[model samples]
Structures are given as structure tokens and as C-alpha cells.
Target: MATNVAMDKKPARQTVPNAIFSLDVVKEKERYDLWRESIACIFEVDGDRALRRTSDFKAHVDANMFGPIMLARTWTQQQDWKRSPSIMARDGMDHYMIQLFEHGQMQWEDGTGLRELPKGGLIVFDLAQAVKTRTNDFCNLSLIIPRTMMDGALKPQFDQHLRVLAKGEPMVKLLRDHMLSLKSVSDRMSVRQAIEVAPATVGLAAACLNAAVDRENPHQGAGIALAQLTVIRRFIEANLSEPALSVDWIARHAGASRTKLYKLFDAFGGVGTYIRDRRLRRALLALVDETAQYRPIYDIALASGYTSDAAFSRAFRAKYGIAPRDIRGNQARLVDIGLPTDDKVDRRYERWLHHLSV
Candidate 1:
């Protein structure tokens, strides 16, 4: 519940430069002129090839391209030459560049290997080493981030793989969707949002790469998967009263397979059983609340996903060893029951009583 501002309020000295621009409204040549000026100023590129331009698709480049953390531009271009190099120099900064190509073909060297990227391929390269890229007609999304970020999050697999196509990976699809969503509002990202999203974006990138390469580290993939599943469970709890809720519906909305979804809730039992227990718990709390005495038992049952009051009462008695009517009648008296004399009482019983007044 703590705000990000409250967590890191030392004020970062504002040393990180901002290099964002838009090319939709400018002339083609003028846009290209501004691109050279902005990139050269930020990266401090002294060579003429550092400012070279290669194609004409009305392309636009707006980026925060320096320091330990930077944003890479996503552009669509068509090249007539057999080999065209966009930028082939070193910035003396130790960072990793990630490229996710959507279409066409390109090749590059990342010090360890010569990576050839086809359509739907992904490439990760080091910035300290000299690299050359050749593309005929390419459209891709690129990310420039600190090497330490990958070192901590990715660990062993960070250096083992240079390029991947990300075939059949759910995390890759999620990263693609998030990047596209961010691109839709590139002009409106606040400085704080951009900073917070940077690490989360890196985490996703690491997850996609690890998933693609079949890495053995379960912690990286499990952490992101659990966080996403927690969000989905919160959504399910918020809409419990709606009769349309089901495993298939929640899985579809969360963009996960039913088997993966079930595995996510393994610590709490399976997804279907979890849903049933949550509903039963809610119904039990309703039964114990003094103000709910006027409500019909059938209404509470329906609200908890039970079609019939008789079936709800059966399951409630099987779990709690008491009828729902008795609990509703003795609601006020049950509060007098003393806290556990030993440490053997069920915790769910305490939780139900705690939320009864809310």
C-alpha cells in the first residue's frame, strides 16, 4: 500500500537527461535533421557514420538513449541497399540492447556470436562492443537497458543466448502487448511512471527471454507468473457476486491456459476448489454478521454461486459442523466465544469473524 514516491523520496538529482521527440508533424528532412542533432547530443557520437540515415518510410525516432537506463525507438523502414548500418560505434557505456523484430530480416554481432534475426525474432546485444546491423526492410521494437539489470534478474542465461525468436512463450506475448500499449501513449508518460515501468519492463523482457531459451531458473518465471496471477485473483474476488464468473472466463480474461492457471493456485489448492472455498467463506461471514439476519438464505446462497439453498446448507454443515440457521440465530452470542486457549484452532474461523463487522 506504500506509494513509490514515499518509498524513494531522496530526489534523484535530476541528472538523467530527457531526449523525447515526435516526428508526426515535421517534414521528412527536418525530422531526420532533428534525429541527428538529438542522438548526437545525447550519445556524444563524433563520427559521421553515427548520424547516417538509411530509408524513407516517413520514419520517426524519439528516444531516451544514454546513461545506464535508456529507451529504444521502434520504427518501420524499407531499405534498397544490400546492407545498411544504422549506427556502428561504441558509447563507452556498459549496457544491453534488446531488439524484437516484427517483420523483415536483419543481422548483428554481439561480441559472442553473429545473430541473424528473422521476422518475430529477438536479439540482445552489448553496447560496449562494436556491432553492425544490416536490414533489407525491417520493423522492430528495441530496448536499451543497463547490463547490471540483466545480470541480477537474468543471471546465468543473460550471456548464453544472443538471439531468440520467442516461439510459443506466453511471457513473450505479454511483453509484446505491454510494449504496444505503452507505445500508444509514448507522448504522455510521466517521469515517475517511466522510471517505475523501466524495471518492470526489464523483468518482463528477462522472463520472455528465459522462457524462450528453456532456462532452468524457476524463480524468474515463477515471480512474474505469481504476480500476474495475484492480480487475476484480486479481480475475481472483486466480481464474486456476478453469476457469470467461471474458470474459463477468468482464464480467458487473464490470457492464461487453464492448466497454467490451475498450477498458479496450487499452493491454495486448484482454481475450481479455490473458487468454491472463497464463495463458502463469504457465505459464512454473511451468516455470522448481525445485520444480515433479514436477508433470505437462498439469496446468500445464490450470491455465493450456489444454485440452491439446500446444497449450500449441506456443504456449510459438512465444513463447520453446524447449520446456517443456528449460526444466524446465535450471531451475537458467538462473539463471546473466547480466543483459542491453545494454538490448534482453524485460522479460517478467525478470518471469518474478523471480517464479519466489515
Candidate 2:
């Protein structure tokens, strides 16, 4: 038996300004107050009066600015945190926050009512909206994105605040991995690189949010239809090779009636046509892929749910105006495939949060 070995290389660490604040160095008597005052610009914190007497107050934040985005890690003891209308009005921190708690639990109330985040789930917060949370000892990674940037990636009608994505969701898992990677490699990135990559991070965050939306059962309407359609498209893309892929199968799995499914995909000429087009497009990519150049065309067709070579060729030709073989070795460019800066310590993060729009 032969096995392949994986090669790993350490990232070259670069010197960049990163803000760090910790209660470790602060006197025990002053730790709670310092922690409270430090993040006052964003949230008001209050300790359990009883716990304050017996517990060792602990909290710290290590943060970096990526263009208009901010990423940070915070560890804190049991506390209650709030962001009220007055706080929102005073600081005017109009950003979207995505948080994943690596440890502990939190229960928060917002415009959407009560939402609880158990360990390992991702939670979103809209700074423009008010929220209050009570937490146990926890460590969390936080991403702060300017609303303007996040808005472009999310649907306007989708209520994102207080929405939580379970740790098990595939997209949420990938997003968590991305946030951790960003934190690790950020030091190696230049201000311009950080700025350039901010949008990509925002896009991933939006995907996770939309995936969360799909997991919920929404009422009938254009907004619901659109959200369902997004989920269906992803499903179709993932299962294109299934021989049982059909409108009825999709409708059953997608939890939509045949009429609703058809109506939802009307702009794409109908679900059947859309699926066929996707299969053909996917087949074309396989044919032109350098790594798959040696792959049998028949195999590609079969994998695309085509049992007969002739049928696959005709559909491929009809959609692309050429046979799959024509573009295989030709390597034609397919037009289809849709593919900071901060320093300071002290109240540094609060200052950065306030000026994130800049």
C-alpha cells in the first residue's frame, strides 16, 4: 500500500500593530472596573455582586484591524453585558458582529426575543440594535464588520441579529475555521492585504447567516421563497450527480410544493431546465479541468446523471453550442464559473470600533 505524506510549513510572522488588553496585569481589586471601563464604548458590563466578592475577576482582549473589519479574542468571567439604545446612540458603533464562543454559554435578548448560545455555536449581533446578555466563564473569537460591508453580502429582509448557527452546520464549521485561520495568519498580512481580504471574510459570514436562515421554517412570501431558493440551489449543486435528481425529488427534499418550486425557479426557465443547465455546465468544467484531462468523457457524463453518451453530448451541445469534446483539449476560457492597521492599547479597541467606518 502507498500513502501520501502531507507537508506543513510555518507561516512567517510579520510585525504589525495589534491591540492587547488584559486584567492579568491589573490589580485584583481593579480588574473588574478596568475590564468594565475598557469595553464601555461597546457594552456595559455588571458582575454578579455575590460572585464579585469570592471570584477572581478575569478578562482580556487581543485584537487586530483588517481594513474596515476587526477580529478579536476575548476571555471573561461570569458577567452581564448590555448595549442599550443610549449606548448605541452615544457610541454610534454601526457594525455587525459575528461571535463564536470557544467555551461557555450565553443567553441574550434582542429585537427577536430571547436567543441562547450554547458552547460551540456562532452568534451574530447588530450593533445598531440593542441587546443584553448574561454569560458564564467563556472564551470567544469575535469579528466586527462594518454594516455597509456586511449589508452588501446579506439580504436586506433577513433578520440577522441574534441569529445563531449551530456548530454542526457545515458552513458554520467552515466559517469558524476561517475566523481562527485569520487570527493566526493576520500577523503575516500587510494592511493592504488585510483590506483586500475583508470582503472575502464578510462573504463567508453572510453564507453562514443565510445557511442559518435556511435551517429555519419561514412563512410563505417572496422573501421566504427567495431564501428557500438559495438553499435549493446549493442542494442541486451538491447532488447534481444523483440519478434520482428531479423536480419531485428536489421538492420533497426541499420541503416545497411542486408549484412553489416551479414558481421559485421561473426566472431560470423552470427547475428541470435549471438542473439540466447546471449538469451541462458542470460536465464542461470537468472536461476542461487540467487534472481531469485524462478522465473518460463517458464517466463524466454518467456522473452527471446521463446514462447514455449521446444524450449528454446533445444536451451539452444545445446549451454550449459545441460538443464537450470540442472544448476538452482546447482549453477554452469558460465564462461560467462564479468565483488593517491598528495600534494602541488601553481603550484602543473601543476607539477602533467607533472608527471602523473610517
Candidate 3:
């Protein structure tokens, strides 16, 4: 019972508050130790590293947290970070960090493998996993979230098979822009408002990294391909009325091969069928709007990317089992024709996102 009681006490964690630090304030010899303690509180990283040059230790820090997720901006000289098994056991946190390297070179090795951190790179690091990072002078921005939150949003295999997200990857660019956008206004945001925005960031990050992992797994044959397909479907939805919504266009923009693209949407009967079905759904919504009743079906069909009303009507009936005009001017009423829907994905992302709100 005493041992159980001892285990019940929570270990100390860094405070979620506004903070700042500067190496200029400390004596040269003492600055290295001060940096270690300051950074531990800043990142909840209570591991070990030896400064390569203590005589002229130089770093500046500014940090904030929306909630459990934190953003830290750091400038440092070279250091070799070594997180040992014992250090991890004593750290008292379980989380993952997606760090953006703005200006620096970091070569990191862990259970996965070693890779030179890309310029303007965003990479994920798991606190529970041992990692070694050898870096030259560098500046970085990092987003830290609990392990469970990321696991809910991304694939379960993410931590087990970690990889560096190279610069210019679509998902990497999206996440980089997202974090930078939030930072531009974070200083004015209240803790509660910032908290609300945290999960959406996590969702976007998960979607981005999921794309990276999926892109690497074409050889493995369908390792979380649904997440990648979700990305393509979203791209398609946004461009439904586009003249470039053809398979070749999607394959090119989405960086998926024609064969790979076809395999991903096989359950939807085929890519063309899926695109045609979704276009009709959008047209049905537009047609049912009372404000849009003045528009002719022929005009609606053309805007819906159909060349002719006859082609649109035939596709619409085959999908919704009813003529498009039947639902006209219905004013937001959803007429259920019970068309086959795709679960091509899961709702786990919602739960992951909700975790940030709390």
C-alpha cells in the first residue's frame, strides 16, 4: 500500500505560462547548466547533453503553450543531445514533438535510423523513445502534444516507424504554414482561445504526417492508405467543378500513379464513378436551395462540370435513384436515395481533435 501510495503522486511538469530566457544574462561557465534547466521546463525534456563550447554559450528562448501543446522558439550553438533509458524513465512525460527546423543542421538517430534534418524540416520525436541528435548552431520551432493525442489522429505505426519529414513535402509545407500562421497571432490569444485552436493544429499535423508515411508505404501494399485517400478525396471535393478533375489530373497533383490511384478507390467502384457521384451530390445540394431555384438544370449541370444536362441527369439518377429536378427548391432538405457511401476512412481523427479542447 505504501508503494501504491508513492506511485499515485504525479511527477512535476513544466508550467503552462509565458516565459523567456537569454544566455547573455548568465556567466559563461554557468550558462550551460542554466540552459539545461530552463529548456527542461520549456520542453519538459529532462534528459542529458553536453555543450560543445561552454566558454561562449549562446542561446535565447521564448515559449508559449495553447494547452498541452507547446510552441518553443530556440537559438543555440552546437550540442549533442543524448537521451538515455534511465533519463526517459525519470522524465515523467509521454508525448511527441513535431519540430520545425528553421535554421540549423541536426543529424538524429533513434530506434528507427539516422537522417540529416532537412533545412526548413518538420520532424516527429517521441519522448519515450531514446534519441541522439548531433547538431551545429540551429534554430527550431516545435509543437509538443501527448503521445495518445497523436496516436489517435495518425497511424498507430507512426512512433514505431518514425521518419524525418523532408522539406517541400506537401504535408510538411501545410503543417509549417499552419504553425507559422498560429504563431503570428498567438501573443494576442487568451489561454482558452489558444486551447480551442490546439486540436485543429493537431488534426492538420496528423493529416500531414499520415501523408508522408503513406507515401513511403506503396511497397508495403496498403499501410494506412485510407488516410492518404482521404487527402485525395478532399482535394477532389475542393475541385469538383474544375475542368482538371480528371484521373490524370488527380494522379499528377496527388503524386499517385494511375494504377495506384485506381487501386485506392476500388471500393468506390472506380475513380470516374466516384468523381461523377460526388459531383451530382454537390449539384443536388445546389439545386435544392430555394435561392438557386431560378437557375435552369442545364446551367446547374454545366457548372457541376457536366458538358450537358442529359449526361448529368443520367449520372444523377444512377447515383441518387431519382431525377435531379425532383429535389429542386427543397430548401436544405436532404432526400435520401441511400447511395452507397464510402467509409474509405474512420472518425478517429475527431476523437484526437477533441482531446485538445479539453
Candidate 4:
């Protein structure tokens, strides 16, 4: 977007120095050294052998902090970039890089088999691990997730096994498109807006990593199940008026079994209970609206999937300790439904956010 061309690096914000940066690789007599510095500054890694080949290098970076995680994107061309054992020892290591490559002929090794990404692909490699890379032209959007922030994300076996995400994989493609969109609009964002998007960045990256790893292992990824639960929740909300919306339907929609669906929604109680509670919750909102008074209770009941008014009324009273008609008379507003309605779900999310801050 708005790039500061060939200028010295300066802090975008006083409080957080790394909000954004732009550098145009100025070609001077010692331009090779400057290129090396540019690569190091842009990627926060070491050993830029590409500067030896050509001095034509320029890059821009937009970095935002979400808790301790940093979301960043760089558009630049450099040849070979390596993070060797010496660099690791010198820099000290406690972070991992998850990169979505847009263009590059990159052959990178992390003491495992080499992953050569020429086109579209993503890579997740830890800094504590060994790294050596040879590349022709490389450009990417990446995130730096501190090891502590990755607590529930990376298992030991996964850290050792899954590193590169192939171009055509579903999760990789989705994350790539997502980051591209984020980058396109990032220049217009404020520090507050950038901070607000950090959790989304973490969640999306975590989901993609888990999906890719589970796909490789073929043991039915729990990550996929967790991600799919979010989709199913939206589906349930959209179809609450339908009479056939049930636990079986939700399981089928999620591609999860009835048992798995039950477990996924255990925090909200059983699947059926959750669906009923949500429907009743919506019905409560409708019941309190003056605009909806023209519609009879039986109509609202049927719309909420009840066969008759009696069943809906009984369920409503059992849940709320009041008849449906009484809500309007008693001036029941949104507080009558209670805040959030699920402490178990809220606490679970609170703990996840806390881990990110750590």
C-alpha cells in the first residue's frame, strides 16, 4: 500500500516499534551488505547468500501484535536465505515461522527431508531447529508465533513431522487466500485494529497447521473436528426454524459421528439440549419484541420447530421459569436471557487467550 521507499528503518508507533517497516535496497558500492541487512531485517532470520548474486533487492513489512504473536507480510525478492546452526546460536531461538509462499523457488531443510516450494505452499519451522535453504526468488506472508503461544497447537510428534504444506492442500489454500486479503487491507489499519485481528491470525494459523498435520497422519484430525464445530454452530443458527434440525442432522453436516458431535457440544450439554436452548433463546428475543406482537404465540412456536403452542410454552417455562406471554408484560429485555449463557464456553476461550499472552 503506502510504502516508504529506500528509507532508514524507524518505528511506526512509539509504544510498539514493529507495527510496519519499508526498505528499498539501495544499490551503492557496499550494496551487497545492505541487501544482507535488508533480508535480515525483513525476515528476522540470517545468512542472505542471495545478495552475492544480485543487488536488486527491495522489501516492505507490515507487522502487528496480537498478544505475543506477530502477524507480518513481506513482498520482496532475494535469492538464497539460510538460518544455520551458528545463526541459531547467535540469535537465540524461541519462535516458529509459519509462511505462506506466493512466489519462490525455495529448497529448505530443517534437519528433515528438504521441502522445495516453487509455487504455492506454506512452511512451519521452528528456530530452535536447524535450517538451511537455497532459493532463486522468494516472497511470502508469514507469522511469528512464540513457542509459548503455541501451547495447544503443536505436539512433539507434529513438530518433528509436519513442516511444509503442499500448494494444493485445502487448508493451505484457505490460509494463503486469507493472509493475502489481510495484507491487501493492512495498510489502512490502526494499531488498535491490528491488535484486534491478532487472535484471528493465531486461530486461523493454528487451524491450518492442525488440519495439515492431521491430513498427513489420517487418524481423523481432532483439529478438523474442532474447526468444523464452528461451521456447524453457524449452520444450526441459520436453520433453527426448521423442524428437522436435530443432533443427527448436525453430526451429518459436520462430517462427524453422533458420538463425536455429542462430545464436541458437551460444554453446552448434549447436542439436542444445545439446539433446543438456542432455539428457545431466539424465541425469547422474538417474544420480547413489540414488533412481533401481531404474530400469535402458536405461530412463533411453530416457527421455532414446535408442533403446537403447548409444547413450546412448557419448554419455555421449564427453561426460564415463566410463560412466554408474561415476558412482554414484565418488561423483560436482553438481560432476562442472562449474559453469554455459557460460562464453560467463556472460560475455555479465556484460557486460550491467556496462553497466547504467555
Q: Could you estimate the TM-score for every candidate?
A: 0.41, 0.58, 0.51, 0.48
lDDT (10s digit) by residue, model 4, range 1-358: 2355435566575232243444343444454454344344222333356554454545455654544666565555555565543333223334667777666666765334676764677777665444566655556777676655566765434442226777787878887887777667765666677776766777777788777765344323543553455456657767888888888776666566888777767655567876787778677767866798777888788778888788899999988888987776665332243311221111122122112334
Rank by lDDT (best first): 2, 3, 4, 1
Candidate 1: which stretches are off by over 4 Å? 1-59, 64-68, 76-90, 108-116, 157-161, 215-358
Q: Which ten contiguous residues of candidate 3 have the minimum total lDDT? A: 338-347
Q: What is the C-alpha lDDT of each candidate?
A: 0.54, 0.75, 0.64, 0.59
Ranking by TM-score: 2, 3, 4, 1
lDDT of 3: 0.64
Residue 258 of model 4, lDDT score: 83
Put down candidate 1 lDDT per residue, 1-358, tens digits, no spaces: 4697698777554432343345566555454544333333112222233224422424444444222355545453433221111111111233566767666787656445675665554666654333446654455666666555776566452342245546346776787776666655655665666666777877887787667765554344544663455456666666666666777988777677888777776655567656766676678767765687788888998888788878889987775667777776554434332111122222222222122112
Model 2 TM-score is: 0.58
Model 2 C-alpha lDDT per residue in residues 1-358, reported as the tens digit of each score: 1233223545555444588886666667766766676777688889877666654877888999988889999998888998875555345456789999888889976446777885688888877666789999998999998876765577656656677788898999999999999999977887778878888998998888877676433422544554566567768877888878999998888787899888877766678877787787568657866798889899999888888999999988777677788775433323222101121325467667877877
User: How high a TM-score does candidate 4 get?
Assistant: 0.48
Clashes of 2: 0
Q: Which of the two candidates, 3 or 4, achieves a greater TM-score against the reference?
A: 3
Worst lDDT 10-window in candidate 1: 82-91
Cα RMSD for candidate 3? 21.9
Q: Quick one: how many clashes does candidate 1 have?
A: 0
